[model samples]
Target: MKVRAATEADLPAILAIYNHAVVHSTCTADYQPQTLAQRRQWFDVRVQAKLPVLVAVGEGGVVAGWASLNPFKERAGYRFTVENSVYIHPERRGQGIGKLLLEPLIAEARALGMHVIIAGIDSENAASIRLHERFGFRNVGHLPQVIYKFDRWLDVVYLQLSM
Candidate 1:
C-alpha cells in the first residue's frame, strides 16, 4: 500500500467510506450522507487552506482509507491546533489501514508547525482509541451523552498529541 496526498479522483472513494460510517457506525456523528458537491466543497476548502488530506492506496489503486488534518476552530487562538480524522473503507477495516493513514498525518501536522493534534472519537470505539493511544495521544477529555444518534446518546473521547 502507498500513502499519498488525495486528489480529485479519490473523492468518490473517500465519500463512500465516510458515508458508510455515517450511516452504519458511530465513527462520525453526522446522520445524513454528504452529497458529492458537498464533499467537493469540503475538499476545496481544505485545499485552499493548504491542510493535509491524505489517502491510502492499496492494491489495484483502490483507496483503502483516508486521513486529514482540519482546523480545530475558526478562532485565531486555535490556529496552532488541528483536529484529525481517519476513515477506513468498511470492508478494509482491521487491515491496519487506519494506522497506515495516521502515522504520516501526524508527521504532516508537525511538519506544518502545528502545536497539537486532536482526535475526537466515539467512546465505544476501542479500536480507534487504541490506535490513537498507540501513537502517544493522551486522553484529555471525555464528554458523556453529548451526541444523540441511533436513538441513543453517545460519548466523545478527546485525545491530544503535542506535535
Candidate 2:
C-alpha cells in the first residue's frame, strides 16, 4: 500500500471509514453517521489550515486507512500542538495500514514545525494505544469514564509525542 495526501476524491472512502468506526466500534464516541457534506466541510477546513490529511491506498487503489494532524484546540496558544487521528478500513485492520499512515503523519507534523502531537485513544482500545506508543507517544493523561457510548461508560487515554 502507498500512503499519500488525501484528495477530494478520497472523501467518500474517508467518510465511510469514519462512520463505520462511529457506529460499530469504540474508536470514536460519535453515535451517528456523518454526512458527506460534513466530511467535505471538514476536508475544507483542514486544507485551509494547511494541515495534512493522508490516505493509505492499498491494492486496486482502494483507501485502506487515513490519518491526519488537527489543531489540538482553537485557541492560538495551542497552535504548535496538534492532535493525530488514524482510522483504518474495518475489513483491513491488523495489516499495518495504520503503521503506514502514522509514520508520514508524524513526519508531516514535524515538517510543519509542530511542537507536539497528541493522541486521544479509548482506554479499551489497546491496539490503538499500542500503535501510538510504538510511534513514541507517551501516556500523558487518562480521563476515567468520561465518555458514554454503546451504552457503556468509556475512558479516554491521552498520549503525547514531542517533536
Candidate 3:
C-alpha cells in the first residue's frame, strides 16, 4: 500500500467509502449519503484551509482508505487544534490501511504546526478506539447519545493526541 496526499481523482473513492460508513455504520453520525458535489465542496474547503487530506492506494491503484485533518472549530481559540477523520473501504478493513492513512495525516498535522489532533469516534467502535490508543491518543471524554442514527442512540468518544 502507498499513502499520499489526495488528488481530485481520489474524491469519488473517498466519497464512496465515506457514504458507505455514513449509511450503514455508526462510525459517522451523518445519516444521509453525501453527494459528489458535497464531497467536492469538502475537498475545496480543505484546500482553502491548507489542511491535509490523504489517501492510501492499494494494488491496481484503488484508494483503500483515506484520512484528513479539519479545523476543530472556526473560533480563533481552536485554531491550534484539528479534528481527524479516517475511512476505509469496507472490503479493505483489517489490512492496516486505516493506520497507513492516519500516520501520515498525523505527521502532516504536526508539520503544519497543529498542537492537537482530535478524533471523535462512535463509542461502540472498539477498533477505532484501539487504533487511536495505539497512536498515543488519550481518551478525553465521552458524550452519551450525542447522535441518533439508524433508529438508535449513539455515544461519541473523544480522543486527543497532543503534537
Candidate 4:
C-alpha cells in the first residue's frame, strides 16, 4: 500500500468510507451521511488551509483509507493545534490501513510546525484507542454521554499527542 496526499478524485471514496461509519457505527457523531457537495466543500477548506488530507492506496489503486488534520477550534489561540481523523473502508478495517494513514499524518503535522494533535474518539472504539496509544497519544479526557447516536448516548475519549 502507498500513502499519499489525496487529490480531488479521491473524495468520493473517502466520502463513502466516512458515510459507512456514520450510518453503521458510532465512530463519528454525525447522524447523517454528508452530501458529495458538502464533502467537497470540506475538502476545499482543508486544502485552502494547507492541511494534509492523505489517502492510502491499495492494490489496483483503491482508496483503502483516508486521514486528515483539522483545525481543533476556530479560536486564534488554537492555531497550532489540530484534530486528527482517520477512516478506513469497512471491508479494509483491521489491516493496518489506519496506521499507515496516521503515521504519515503525524509526521506531516510536525513538519507543518503544529504544536499538538488531538483525537476525539468514541470510547467504545478499542482498536482506535489502541492505535493512538501506539503512536504516543495520551488519554487527556473522557466525557460521558457527550454524543447521542445510534439511539443511545455515546461517550467520547479525547487523546492528545504533543509535537
| Top candidate (lDDT) | 4
Pick the winner on lDDT between candidates 1 and 3: 1
TM-score of candidate 1 on Cα atoms, chains taken together: 0.98
Q: For residues 1-163, could you state the per-residue lDDT of candidate 1 as single tens digits?
A: 9999999999999999999999999879999999999999999989998999999998899999999999899999999999999998888889898999999999989888999999999999999999999999999999999999999999999999996
**Cα-based lDDT for every prediction:** 0.94, 0.94, 0.92, 0.95
- Model 4, range 1-163, lDDT digits (tens) per residue? 9999999999999999999999999989998999999999999999999999999998899999999999899999999999999999999899998898889999999999999999999999999999999999999999999999877998999999997
Worst 10 residues of 2 by lDDT: 93-102
C-alpha lDDT (0 to 100) for residue 142 of candidate 1: 97
Report residue 13 deviation for candidate 3 (angstroms).
0.5
TM-score of each: 0.98, 0.98, 0.98, 0.98
List residue ranges in candidate 2 displaced over 4 A.
none
Candidate 3 residue-wise lDDT, 87-153, digit = tens: 8899999888878877888889988999999999999999899888989999999999999988889
Local lDDT at 15 for model 3 = 99
Least well predicted 10-residue stretch by lDDT in candidate 1: 88-97
Clashes of each: 0, 0, 0, 0
Model 1 gets an lDDT of 0.94
Weakest lDDT window of 10 consecutive positions for candidate 4: 146-155
Off by over 4 Å in 3: none
What is the Å distance of residue 69 in model 4 from its true position?
A: 0.3
- Using alpha carbons, what is the TM-score of model 3? 0.98
CA deviation > 4 Å runs, candidate 4: none
RMSD (Cα, Å) of candidate 2? 0.6
C-alpha lDDT (0 to 100) for residue 71 of candidate 4: 87
